[model samples]
Target: MGYYLMKFFSWVACRFSMEKCNSFGKVLGKLTWIVVPKKRKFMAYDNIIRCLGVDAGEAERIAKASWVQFGPMLMEVLRYPELIKDDYIKKYVTIDGLEYLQEAIDNKQGAVIATSHSDSWELMGAALAQYGVPLVGVAKKQKDSAMDRFINEYRTLVGMHITYTNGVREMFKMIKEGWMIGLITDQDPLWSDGVVLDFFNRKTNCFVGPASIARTQKAPIFHGQIVHRPDGGHHITIYPPIFVDQTKDKKEDIKKATQQIANLLENHIRTHPEDWFWLHDRWKSVREKGLD
Candidate 1:
Protein backbone atom coordinates (compact mmCIF):
# COMPACT_ATOMS: atom_id res chain seq x y z
CA MET A 1 0.00 0.00 0.00
CA GLY A 2 2.78 2.43 0.92
CA TYR A 3 4.68 1.68 -2.26
CA TYR A 4 1.62 2.23 -4.42
CA LEU A 5 0.70 5.46 -2.59
CA MET A 6 4.22 6.81 -3.03
CA LYS A 7 4.26 5.99 -6.73
CA PHE A 8 0.86 7.60 -7.26
CA PHE A 9 1.88 10.78 -5.45
CA SER A 10 5.13 10.88 -7.45
CA TRP A 11 3.24 10.52 -10.72
CA VAL A 12 0.79 13.26 -9.77
CA ALA A 13 3.65 15.55 -8.81
CA CYS A 14 5.44 14.95 -12.09
CA ARG A 15 2.35 15.79 -14.13
CA PHE A 16 1.62 19.11 -12.41
CA SER A 17 3.38 22.35 -13.20
CA MET A 18 4.41 24.60 -10.26
CA GLU A 19 1.65 27.05 -11.15
CA LYS A 20 -0.93 24.30 -11.31
CA CYS A 21 0.27 22.94 -7.96
CA ASN A 22 -0.17 26.37 -6.40
CA SER A 23 -3.69 26.68 -7.81
CA PHE A 24 -4.49 23.26 -6.39
CA GLY A 25 -3.14 24.47 -3.07
CA LYS A 26 -5.64 27.32 -3.03
CA VAL A 27 -8.44 24.85 -3.57
CA LEU A 28 -7.01 22.61 -0.86
CA GLY A 29 -6.92 25.55 1.52
CA LYS A 30 -10.63 26.13 1.01
CA LEU A 31 -11.27 22.41 1.48
CA THR A 32 -9.27 22.44 4.69
CA TRP A 33 -11.54 25.17 6.08
CA ILE A 34 -14.52 22.90 5.43
CA VAL A 35 -12.98 19.68 6.73
CA VAL A 36 -10.91 20.76 9.74
CA PRO A 37 -13.00 20.47 12.91
CA LYS A 38 -14.26 23.66 14.48
CA LYS A 39 -12.58 22.70 17.75
CA ARG A 40 -9.19 22.57 16.09
CA LYS A 41 -9.86 25.83 14.28
CA PHE A 42 -10.89 27.51 17.51
CA MET A 43 -7.78 26.24 19.24
CA ALA A 44 -5.62 27.67 16.50
CA TYR A 45 -7.52 30.93 16.70
CA ASP A 46 -7.09 31.11 20.47
CA ASN A 47 -3.38 30.49 20.21
CA ILE A 48 -3.05 33.27 17.68
CA ILE A 49 -5.18 35.51 19.87
CA ARG A 50 -2.75 35.16 22.75
CA CYS A 51 0.28 35.65 20.54
CA LEU A 52 -0.95 38.73 18.78
CA GLY A 53 -2.90 40.24 21.73
CA VAL A 54 -4.47 43.53 20.60
CA ASP A 55 -3.77 42.65 16.98
CA ALA A 56 -5.75 39.43 17.17
CA GLY A 57 -7.93 40.34 14.20
CA GLU A 58 -4.90 40.89 12.01
CA ALA A 59 -3.30 37.74 13.31
CA GLU A 60 -6.37 35.72 12.40
CA ARG A 61 -6.18 36.93 8.82
CA ILE A 62 -2.52 35.96 8.62
CA ALA A 63 -3.13 32.56 10.23
CA LYS A 64 -5.82 31.79 7.70
CA ALA A 65 -3.56 32.95 4.90
CA SER A 66 -0.95 30.57 6.24
CA TRP A 67 -3.30 27.67 5.64
CA VAL A 68 -3.17 28.64 1.97
CA GLN A 69 0.61 28.97 1.99
CA PHE A 70 0.95 25.67 3.89
CA GLY A 71 -0.78 23.73 1.12
CA PRO A 72 1.75 24.79 -1.51
CA MET A 73 4.47 24.35 1.06
CA LEU A 74 3.57 20.69 1.55
CA MET A 75 3.30 20.23 -2.20
CA GLU A 76 6.78 21.72 -2.49
CA VAL A 77 8.02 19.16 -0.01
CA LEU A 78 6.56 16.41 -2.16
CA ARG A 79 8.29 17.91 -5.22
CA TYR A 80 11.58 18.72 -3.45
CA PRO A 81 13.64 16.02 -5.17
CA GLU A 82 13.23 17.88 -8.46
CA LEU A 83 13.17 21.41 -7.04
CA ILE A 84 16.64 21.13 -5.46
CA LYS A 85 18.19 20.30 -8.80
CA ASP A 86 17.17 23.62 -10.39
CA ASP A 87 19.64 26.51 -10.20
CA TYR A 88 16.75 29.00 -9.98
CA ILE A 89 15.99 27.77 -6.46
CA LYS A 90 18.96 29.92 -5.50
CA LYS A 91 17.17 33.02 -6.73
CA TYR A 92 14.26 32.28 -4.44
CA VAL A 93 16.49 31.65 -1.42
CA THR A 94 19.03 34.30 -0.48
CA ILE A 95 21.40 33.36 2.30
CA ASP A 96 22.73 36.21 4.40
CA GLY A 97 25.51 35.86 7.01
CA LEU A 98 26.97 32.80 5.25
CA GLU A 99 30.40 34.28 5.88
CA TYR A 100 29.83 33.65 9.59
CA LEU A 101 29.10 29.97 8.82
CA GLN A 102 32.24 29.81 6.72
CA GLU A 103 34.28 31.31 9.55
CA ALA A 104 33.13 28.61 11.97
CA ILE A 105 33.83 25.86 9.44
CA ASP A 106 37.27 27.29 8.71
CA ASN A 107 38.08 27.15 12.41
CA LYS A 108 37.38 23.39 12.48
CA GLN A 109 34.54 23.92 14.96
CA GLY A 110 31.12 22.46 14.29
CA ALA A 111 28.23 24.94 14.66
CA VAL A 112 24.53 24.84 15.52
CA ILE A 113 22.08 26.42 13.05
CA ALA A 114 18.74 27.17 14.74
CA THR A 115 15.53 27.98 12.87
CA SER A 116 11.80 27.73 13.48
CA HIS A 117 8.92 25.88 11.78
CA SER A 118 8.56 28.82 9.45
CA ASP A 119 8.05 28.94 5.70
CA SER A 120 9.33 25.91 3.82
CA TRP A 121 11.94 25.05 6.46
CA GLU A 122 12.82 21.67 4.97
CA LEU A 123 14.02 23.40 1.81
CA MET A 124 16.55 25.37 3.84
CA GLY A 125 18.16 22.16 5.10
CA ALA A 126 18.18 20.66 1.61
CA ALA A 127 19.95 23.76 0.28
CA LEU A 128 22.69 23.51 2.91
CA ALA A 129 23.16 19.80 2.29
CA GLN A 130 23.45 20.42 -1.46
CA TYR A 131 26.41 22.72 -0.77
CA GLY A 132 28.24 19.73 0.85
CA VAL A 133 27.83 21.01 4.38
CA PRO A 134 27.56 18.03 6.69
CA LEU A 135 24.10 19.00 7.99
CA VAL A 136 22.29 16.84 10.53
CA GLY A 137 18.67 17.68 11.44
CA VAL A 138 16.97 16.55 14.65
CA ALA A 139 13.28 15.65 14.43
CA LYS A 140 10.63 14.01 16.57
CA LYS A 141 9.60 10.57 15.44
CA GLN A 142 6.16 10.56 13.81
CA LYS A 143 3.43 8.44 15.38
CA ASP A 144 3.04 6.16 12.38
CA SER A 145 6.18 4.08 11.93
CA ALA A 146 5.63 3.71 8.22
CA MET A 147 5.14 7.44 7.75
CA ASP A 148 8.29 8.16 9.72
CA ARG A 149 10.25 5.74 7.58
CA PHE A 150 8.90 7.26 4.41
CA ILE A 151 9.73 10.85 5.45
CA ASN A 152 13.22 9.88 6.55
CA GLU A 153 13.84 8.15 3.25
CA TYR A 154 12.61 11.25 1.40
CA ARG A 155 14.95 13.53 3.36
CA THR A 156 17.93 11.26 2.76
CA LEU A 157 17.10 11.28 -0.93
CA VAL A 158 18.04 14.96 -0.90
CA GLY A 159 21.27 14.32 1.04
CA MET A 160 20.12 15.53 4.49
CA HIS A 161 20.86 13.45 7.62
CA ILE A 162 18.32 12.90 10.39
CA THR A 163 18.64 12.28 14.11
CA TYR A 164 15.64 11.24 16.16
CA THR A 165 14.78 13.27 19.27
CA ASN A 166 15.81 10.44 21.63
CA GLY A 167 19.27 10.13 20.13
CA VAL A 168 21.14 12.81 22.05
CA ARG A 169 24.29 10.79 22.01
CA GLU A 170 24.14 10.48 18.23
CA MET A 171 23.67 14.24 17.90
CA PHE A 172 26.70 14.80 20.10
CA LYS A 173 28.72 12.36 18.02
CA MET A 174 27.71 14.12 14.81
CA ILE A 175 28.87 17.45 16.21
CA LYS A 176 32.15 15.98 17.39
CA GLU A 177 32.75 14.74 13.86
CA GLY A 178 32.39 18.37 12.65
CA TRP A 179 28.87 18.04 11.20
CA MET A 180 26.72 21.17 11.55
CA ILE A 181 23.52 20.52 13.52
CA GLY A 182 20.25 22.14 12.38
CA LEU A 183 17.55 22.39 15.07
CA ILE A 184 14.05 23.87 15.16
CA THR A 185 13.91 25.56 18.56
CA ASP A 186 10.47 27.16 18.36
CA GLN A 187 8.38 24.27 19.62
CA ASP A 188 7.12 24.07 23.19
CA PRO A 189 9.74 22.18 25.16
CA LEU A 190 8.94 19.29 27.47
CA TRP A 191 8.11 20.66 30.91
CA SER A 192 10.96 19.26 32.97
CA ASP A 193 13.85 20.69 30.96
CA GLY A 194 12.40 23.95 29.66
CA VAL A 195 12.79 27.43 31.04
CA VAL A 196 9.95 29.96 30.99
CA LEU A 197 10.84 32.86 28.73
CA ASP A 198 8.91 35.78 27.28
CA PHE A 199 7.71 35.01 23.74
CA PHE A 200 5.36 37.32 21.91
CA ASN A 201 5.18 39.37 25.11
CA ARG A 202 3.84 36.36 27.00
CA LYS A 203 5.63 33.93 29.29
CA THR A 204 6.33 30.61 27.59
CA ASN A 205 8.54 27.59 28.13
CA CYS A 206 11.25 27.24 25.52
CA PHE A 207 13.79 24.48 24.97
CA VAL A 208 17.30 25.26 26.09
CA GLY A 209 18.97 22.53 24.06
CA PRO A 210 20.57 24.78 21.44
CA ALA A 211 22.11 27.03 24.07
CA SER A 212 23.11 24.08 26.23
CA ILE A 213 24.89 22.30 23.42
CA ALA A 214 26.53 25.44 22.12
CA ARG A 215 27.94 26.34 25.51
CA THR A 216 29.08 22.79 26.24
CA GLN A 217 30.85 22.41 22.93
CA LYS A 218 31.94 26.05 22.71
CA ALA A 219 30.28 26.20 19.27
CA PRO A 220 29.07 29.26 17.42
CA ILE A 221 25.32 29.64 16.93
CA PHE A 222 23.62 31.14 13.85
CA HIS A 223 19.98 32.11 13.42
CA GLY A 224 18.22 31.74 10.07
CA GLN A 225 14.69 32.27 8.74
CA ILE A 226 12.97 31.29 5.49
CA VAL A 227 10.62 34.15 4.71
CA HIS A 228 7.82 33.74 2.19
CA ARG A 229 8.25 36.08 -0.74
CA PRO A 230 5.48 37.95 -2.54
CA ASP A 231 6.37 36.19 -5.80
CA GLY A 232 5.45 32.76 -4.37
CA GLY A 233 9.08 31.91 -3.62
CA HIS A 234 11.10 31.96 -0.37
CA HIS A 235 13.97 34.09 0.85
CA ILE A 236 16.24 32.45 3.43
CA THR A 237 17.85 35.08 5.65
CA ILE A 238 20.72 33.99 7.86
CA TYR A 239 21.46 36.30 10.75
CA PRO A 240 24.88 37.00 12.20
CA PRO A 241 26.39 34.54 14.64
CA ILE A 242 25.01 34.53 18.18
CA PHE A 243 28.05 33.17 20.01
CA VAL A 244 27.39 31.38 23.29
CA ASP A 245 29.67 32.74 26.00
CA GLN A 246 31.17 30.11 28.26
CA THR A 247 31.27 32.09 31.45
CA LYS A 248 31.85 30.65 34.92
CA ASP A 249 28.10 30.34 35.33
CA LYS A 250 27.06 27.96 32.58
CA LYS A 251 23.37 28.01 33.52
CA GLU A 252 23.23 31.79 33.38
CA ASP A 253 24.92 31.81 30.00
CA ILE A 254 22.43 29.28 28.67
CA LYS A 255 19.48 31.26 29.96
CA LYS A 256 20.78 34.50 28.51
CA ALA A 257 21.58 33.08 25.10
CA THR A 258 18.33 31.17 24.83
CA GLN A 259 16.40 34.34 25.68
CA GLN A 260 18.34 36.15 22.96
CA ILE A 261 17.29 33.57 20.42
CA ALA A 262 13.70 33.80 21.60
CA ASN A 263 13.81 37.57 21.18
CA LEU A 264 15.02 37.21 17.63
CA LEU A 265 12.26 34.71 16.91
CA GLU A 266 9.69 37.08 18.32
CA ASN A 267 10.86 39.91 16.11
CA HIS A 268 10.77 37.78 13.01
CA ILE A 269 7.30 36.46 13.72
CA ARG A 270 6.09 39.99 14.33
CA THR A 271 7.36 41.12 10.97
CA HIS A 272 5.98 38.14 9.06
CA PRO A 273 2.99 37.02 11.10
CA GLU A 274 1.60 34.79 8.38
CA ASP A 275 4.73 32.74 7.88
CA TRP A 276 4.81 31.26 11.42
CA PHE A 277 3.15 28.11 12.73
CA TRP A 278 0.48 29.48 15.03
CA LEU A 279 -1.48 26.26 15.54
CA HIS A 280 0.79 24.84 18.24
CA ASP A 281 0.04 25.58 21.89
CA ARG A 282 3.32 27.37 22.32
CA TRP A 283 2.22 29.21 25.47
CA LYS A 284 0.01 26.46 26.91
CA SER A 285 2.19 25.43 29.85
CA VAL A 286 2.54 28.91 31.23
CA ARG A 287 -1.08 29.84 30.58
CA GLU A 288 -2.27 26.64 32.25
CA LYS A 289 -0.28 27.51 35.34
CA GLY A 290 -2.00 30.95 35.57
CA LEU A 291 1.32 32.62 34.95
CA ASP A 292 0.60 34.30 31.63
Candidate 2:
Protein backbone atom coordinates (compact mmCIF):
# COMPACT_ATOMS: atom_id res chain seq x y z
CA MET A 1 0.00 0.00 0.00
CA GLY A 2 2.78 2.44 0.90
CA TYR A 3 4.79 1.64 -2.19
CA TYR A 4 1.84 2.05 -4.53
CA LEU A 5 0.91 5.36 -2.94
CA MET A 6 4.43 6.72 -3.53
CA LYS A 7 4.39 5.52 -7.14
CA PHE A 8 1.03 7.13 -7.75
CA PHE A 9 2.23 10.46 -6.41
CA SER A 10 5.42 10.29 -8.46
CA TRP A 11 3.39 9.53 -11.57
CA VAL A 12 1.03 12.42 -10.85
CA ALA A 13 3.90 14.83 -10.20
CA CYS A 14 5.74 13.91 -13.43
CA ARG A 15 2.68 14.76 -15.49
CA PHE A 16 2.39 18.35 -14.20
CA SER A 17 4.45 21.48 -14.53
CA MET A 18 6.57 22.20 -11.44
CA GLU A 19 4.47 25.26 -10.57
CA LYS A 20 1.27 23.29 -10.69
CA CYS A 21 2.82 20.47 -8.71
CA ASN A 22 4.02 22.84 -6.01
CA SER A 23 0.62 24.44 -5.61
CA PHE A 24 -1.05 21.04 -5.34
CA GLY A 25 1.59 19.94 -2.86
CA LYS A 26 0.72 22.78 -0.49
CA VAL A 27 -2.83 21.52 -0.24
CA LEU A 28 -1.66 17.95 0.26
CA GLY A 29 0.68 18.98 3.04
CA LYS A 30 -2.05 20.83 4.93
CA LEU A 31 -4.31 17.82 4.77
CA THR A 32 -1.54 15.54 5.98
CA TRP A 33 -0.94 17.76 8.99
CA ILE A 34 -4.59 17.54 9.93
CA VAL A 35 -4.79 13.74 9.65
CA VAL A 36 -1.51 12.57 11.15
CA PRO A 37 -1.73 11.23 14.75
CA LYS A 38 -1.39 13.53 17.76
CA LYS A 39 2.08 12.39 18.90
CA ARG A 40 3.50 12.76 15.42
CA LYS A 41 1.75 16.08 14.97
CA PHE A 42 2.75 17.66 18.28
CA MET A 43 6.38 16.60 17.95
CA ALA A 44 7.06 19.37 15.47
CA TYR A 45 5.32 21.93 17.64
CA ASP A 46 7.22 20.76 20.71
CA ASN A 47 10.58 20.86 18.96
CA ILE A 48 9.94 24.40 17.78
CA ILE A 49 8.84 25.70 21.15
CA ARG A 50 11.38 23.92 23.33
CA CYS A 51 14.45 24.01 21.14
CA LEU A 52 13.82 27.32 19.40
CA GLY A 53 12.41 29.13 22.48
CA VAL A 54 9.37 30.29 20.54
CA ASP A 55 5.98 30.98 22.06
CA ALA A 56 3.24 28.44 21.44
CA GLY A 57 1.49 30.53 18.79
CA GLU A 58 4.67 31.17 16.86
CA ALA A 59 5.74 27.57 17.24
CA GLU A 60 2.46 26.35 15.84
CA ARG A 61 2.78 28.67 12.90
CA ILE A 62 6.33 27.51 12.23
CA ALA A 63 5.26 23.88 12.62
CA LYS A 64 2.45 24.23 10.12
CA ALA A 65 4.68 26.03 7.66
CA SER A 66 7.18 23.23 7.93
CA TRP A 67 4.40 20.77 7.15
CA VAL A 68 3.27 22.91 4.24
CA GLN A 69 6.79 22.87 2.83
CA PHE A 70 6.81 19.08 3.04
CA GLY A 71 4.32 18.67 0.22
CA PRO A 72 6.30 20.82 -2.17
CA MET A 73 9.51 19.07 -1.10
CA LEU A 74 8.16 15.61 -1.87
CA MET A 75 6.66 16.81 -5.14
CA GLU A 76 9.91 18.42 -6.21
CA VAL A 77 11.81 15.24 -5.39
CA LEU A 78 9.39 13.14 -7.39
CA ARG A 79 9.85 15.49 -10.31
CA TYR A 80 13.59 14.89 -10.50
CA PRO A 81 13.19 13.10 -13.81
CA GLU A 82 12.11 16.40 -15.32
CA LEU A 83 14.58 18.42 -13.26
CA ILE A 84 17.53 16.77 -14.98
CA LYS A 85 16.55 18.23 -18.33
CA ASP A 86 19.05 20.53 -19.98
CA ASP A 87 19.12 24.08 -18.52
CA TYR A 88 16.72 23.14 -15.69
CA ILE A 89 19.41 23.65 -13.08
CA LYS A 90 20.55 26.95 -14.61
CA LYS A 91 16.96 28.16 -14.65
CA TYR A 92 15.91 27.28 -11.10
CA VAL A 93 18.92 26.69 -8.87
CA THR A 94 21.48 29.43 -8.16
CA ILE A 95 24.71 28.50 -6.41
CA ASP A 96 26.97 30.65 -4.25
CA GLY A 97 30.52 29.77 -3.13
CA LEU A 98 31.34 27.66 -6.13
CA GLU A 99 34.97 28.52 -5.54
CA TYR A 100 34.94 26.58 -2.26
CA LEU A 101 33.72 23.43 -4.01
CA GLN A 102 35.87 24.09 -7.05
CA GLU A 103 38.95 24.41 -4.91
CA ALA A 104 38.56 20.87 -3.62
CA ILE A 105 37.90 19.45 -7.07
CA ASP A 106 40.74 21.45 -8.63
CA ASN A 107 43.17 20.22 -5.98
CA LYS A 108 41.98 16.61 -6.39
CA GLN A 109 41.05 16.59 -2.70
CA GLY A 110 37.35 15.74 -2.26
CA ALA A 111 35.23 17.77 0.15
CA VAL A 112 32.78 16.72 2.89
CA ILE A 113 29.67 18.92 2.79
CA ALA A 114 27.83 19.15 6.09
CA THR A 115 24.13 19.69 5.44
CA SER A 116 20.74 19.17 7.08
CA HIS A 117 17.21 18.08 6.17
CA SER A 118 16.21 21.53 5.07
CA ASP A 119 13.76 22.47 2.33
CA SER A 120 14.52 20.73 -0.92
CA TRP A 121 17.59 19.34 0.77
CA GLU A 122 17.83 16.39 -1.57
CA LEU A 123 17.79 18.77 -4.47
CA MET A 124 21.02 20.41 -3.30
CA GLY A 125 23.22 17.44 -4.20
CA ALA A 126 21.30 16.67 -7.37
CA ALA A 127 21.51 20.27 -8.57
CA LEU A 128 25.26 20.33 -7.97
CA ALA A 129 25.62 17.09 -9.89
CA GLN A 130 23.52 18.53 -12.69
CA TYR A 131 25.82 21.54 -12.69
CA GLY A 132 28.78 19.18 -13.30
CA VAL A 133 30.06 18.49 -9.77
CA PRO A 134 30.93 14.90 -9.05
CA LEU A 135 28.86 14.30 -5.86
CA VAL A 136 28.08 11.23 -3.78
CA GLY A 137 25.36 11.71 -1.14
CA VAL A 138 25.38 9.65 2.06
CA ALA A 139 21.82 8.43 2.55
CA LYS A 140 20.03 6.33 5.15
CA LYS A 141 18.13 3.47 3.62
CA GLN A 142 14.41 3.61 4.19
CA LYS A 143 12.80 0.67 5.95
CA ASP A 144 10.48 0.09 3.05
CA SER A 145 12.34 -1.34 0.12
CA ALA A 146 9.98 0.20 -2.43
CA MET A 147 10.47 3.74 -1.14
CA ASP A 148 14.23 3.21 -0.95
CA ARG A 149 14.42 2.01 -4.55
CA PHE A 150 12.18 4.81 -5.76
CA ILE A 151 14.38 7.53 -4.19
CA ASN A 152 17.74 5.97 -5.06
CA GLU A 153 16.70 5.66 -8.73
CA TYR A 154 15.92 9.37 -9.04
CA ARG A 155 19.08 10.25 -7.12
CA THR A 156 21.15 8.30 -9.62
CA LEU A 157 19.12 9.60 -12.55
CA VAL A 158 20.16 13.12 -11.57
CA GLY A 159 23.82 11.97 -11.60
CA MET A 160 24.27 11.68 -7.82
CA HIS A 161 26.41 8.81 -6.64
CA ILE A 162 24.47 7.15 -3.80
CA THR A 163 25.95 5.32 -0.80
CA TYR A 164 24.21 3.99 2.28
CA THR A 165 25.15 5.01 5.85
CA ASN A 166 27.23 1.89 6.54
CA GLY A 167 29.19 2.26 3.31
CA VAL A 168 32.05 4.19 4.92
CA ARG A 169 34.76 2.42 2.94
CA GLU A 170 33.01 3.35 -0.30
CA MET A 171 32.83 6.98 0.81
CA PHE A 172 36.62 7.08 1.38
CA LYS A 173 37.10 5.75 -2.14
CA MET A 174 34.87 8.46 -3.60
CA ILE A 175 36.68 11.13 -1.58
CA LYS A 176 40.03 9.85 -2.81
CA GLU A 177 38.68 10.22 -6.34
CA GLY A 178 37.92 13.89 -5.59
CA TRP A 179 34.15 13.48 -5.60
CA MET A 180 32.24 15.80 -3.27
CA ILE A 181 30.37 13.87 -0.54
CA GLY A 182 27.16 15.25 0.97
CA LEU A 183 26.24 14.20 4.53
CA ILE A 184 22.97 15.18 6.24
CA THR A 185 23.91 15.44 9.93
CA ASP A 186 20.79 16.80 11.60
CA GLN A 187 19.17 13.58 12.74
CA ASP A 188 19.81 11.93 16.11
CA PRO A 189 22.32 9.12 16.29
CA LEU A 190 22.15 6.14 18.62
CA TRP A 191 23.22 7.02 22.16
CA SER A 192 26.23 4.74 22.01
CA ASP A 193 27.45 5.94 18.65
CA GLY A 194 26.93 9.71 18.82
CA VAL A 195 28.78 12.60 20.39
CA VAL A 196 26.60 14.66 22.71
CA LEU A 197 26.57 18.34 21.79
CA ASP A 198 24.66 21.52 22.50
CA PHE A 199 22.02 22.27 19.84
CA PHE A 200 19.82 25.30 20.36
CA ASN A 201 21.07 25.17 24.01
CA ARG A 202 19.78 21.64 24.49
CA LYS A 203 21.98 18.57 24.74
CA THR A 204 21.65 16.07 21.92
CA ASN A 205 23.68 13.35 20.28
CA CYS A 206 25.05 14.13 16.83
CA PHE A 207 26.55 12.01 14.08
CA VAL A 208 30.27 12.70 13.72
CA GLY A 209 30.67 10.92 10.40
CA PRO A 210 31.22 14.05 8.31
CA ALA A 211 33.84 15.46 10.66
CA SER A 212 35.56 12.12 11.11
CA ILE A 213 35.71 11.60 7.37
CA ALA A 214 37.11 15.08 6.77
CA ARG A 215 39.77 14.69 9.47
CA THR A 216 40.81 11.18 8.56
CA GLN A 217 40.71 11.76 4.81
CA LYS A 218 42.41 15.17 5.17
CA ALA A 219 39.50 16.68 3.23
CA PRO A 220 37.96 20.08 3.78
CA ILE A 221 34.55 20.36 5.46
CA PHE A 222 32.13 22.96 4.12
CA HIS A 223 28.73 23.85 5.53
CA GLY A 224 25.99 23.99 2.87
CA GLN A 225 22.24 24.46 2.51
CA ILE A 226 19.50 25.01 -0.11
CA VAL A 227 16.76 27.53 0.57
CA HIS A 228 13.46 27.73 -1.25
CA ARG A 229 13.02 31.16 -2.77
CA PRO A 230 9.71 33.02 -2.79
CA ASP A 231 9.51 32.54 -6.53
CA GLY A 232 9.69 28.74 -6.04
CA GLY A 233 13.35 28.37 -6.92
CA HIS A 234 16.26 27.23 -4.75
CA HIS A 235 19.49 28.97 -3.78
CA ILE A 236 22.40 26.88 -2.53
CA THR A 237 25.01 28.49 -0.30
CA ILE A 238 28.29 26.71 0.47
CA TYR A 239 30.59 28.31 3.00
CA PRO A 240 34.36 28.22 3.01
CA PRO A 241 35.87 24.95 4.22
CA ILE A 242 37.26 24.33 7.73
CA PHE A 243 40.18 22.03 8.10
CA VAL A 244 39.97 19.84 11.22
CA ASP A 245 42.96 20.36 13.53
CA GLN A 246 45.12 17.29 13.11
CA THR A 247 47.27 18.39 16.04
CA LYS A 248 44.41 18.06 18.53
CA ASP A 249 43.44 14.81 20.21
CA LYS A 250 41.37 12.68 17.78
CA LYS A 251 38.22 12.45 19.92
CA GLU A 252 38.42 16.10 20.92
CA ASP A 253 38.91 17.15 17.31
CA ILE A 254 35.87 15.20 16.17
CA LYS A 255 33.80 16.75 18.94
CA LYS A 256 35.00 20.25 18.03
CA ALA A 257 34.26 19.77 14.34
CA THR A 258 30.86 18.33 15.16
CA GLN A 259 30.08 21.29 17.41
CA GLN A 260 30.89 23.69 14.58
CA ILE A 261 28.36 21.89 12.36
CA ALA A 262 25.69 22.00 15.10
CA ASN A 263 26.22 25.74 15.43
CA LEU A 264 25.84 26.24 11.68
CA LEU A 265 22.61 24.21 11.63
CA GLU A 266 21.20 26.23 14.53
CA ASN A 267 21.96 29.49 12.74
CA HIS A 268 20.21 28.40 9.57
CA ILE A 269 17.20 27.03 11.44
CA ARG A 270 16.89 30.24 13.43
CA THR A 271 16.86 32.29 10.26
CA HIS A 272 14.59 29.90 8.35
CA PRO A 273 12.58 28.17 11.06
CA GLU A 274 10.38 26.29 8.67
CA ASP A 275 13.22 24.96 6.54
CA TRP A 276 14.67 22.51 9.06
CA PHE A 277 13.18 19.05 9.67
CA TRP A 278 11.51 19.72 13.00
CA LEU A 279 9.43 16.59 12.75
CA HIS A 280 12.43 14.56 13.83
CA ASP A 281 12.99 13.97 17.55
CA ARG A 282 16.42 15.53 17.51
CA TRP A 283 17.06 15.04 21.22
CA LYS A 284 15.78 11.52 21.41
CA SER A 285 19.04 10.18 22.72
CA VAL A 286 19.08 12.65 25.58
CA ARG A 287 15.47 11.94 26.40
CA GLU A 288 15.85 8.18 26.12
CA LYS A 289 18.92 8.02 28.31
CA GLY A 290 17.54 10.48 30.87
CA LEU A 291 20.47 12.80 30.30
CA ASP A 292 20.31 16.28 31.73
Which window of 10 residues has the lowest lDDT sum in candidate 2? 35-44
Best by TM-score: 2
What TM-score would candidate 2 get against the native?
0.94
Given candidate 2, what's the lDDT at residue 260? 92
Kindly list the per-residue Cα lDDT of model 2 for residues 114-176, writing each as its tens digit. 899898888888888888888998888999998898888888989999999889899999999
Q: Clash pairs of candidate 2?
A: none
lDDT of the candidates, in the order given: 0.78, 0.86
Q: 229-259, model 1: which lDDT tens digit per residue?
A: 7787777777888888778998889989999
Off by over 4 Å in 1: 53-56, 86-88
Q: Score every model by TM-score.
A: 0.92, 0.94
Off by over 4 Å in 2: 1-11
- Candidate 1, residue 286: the lDDT equals 78
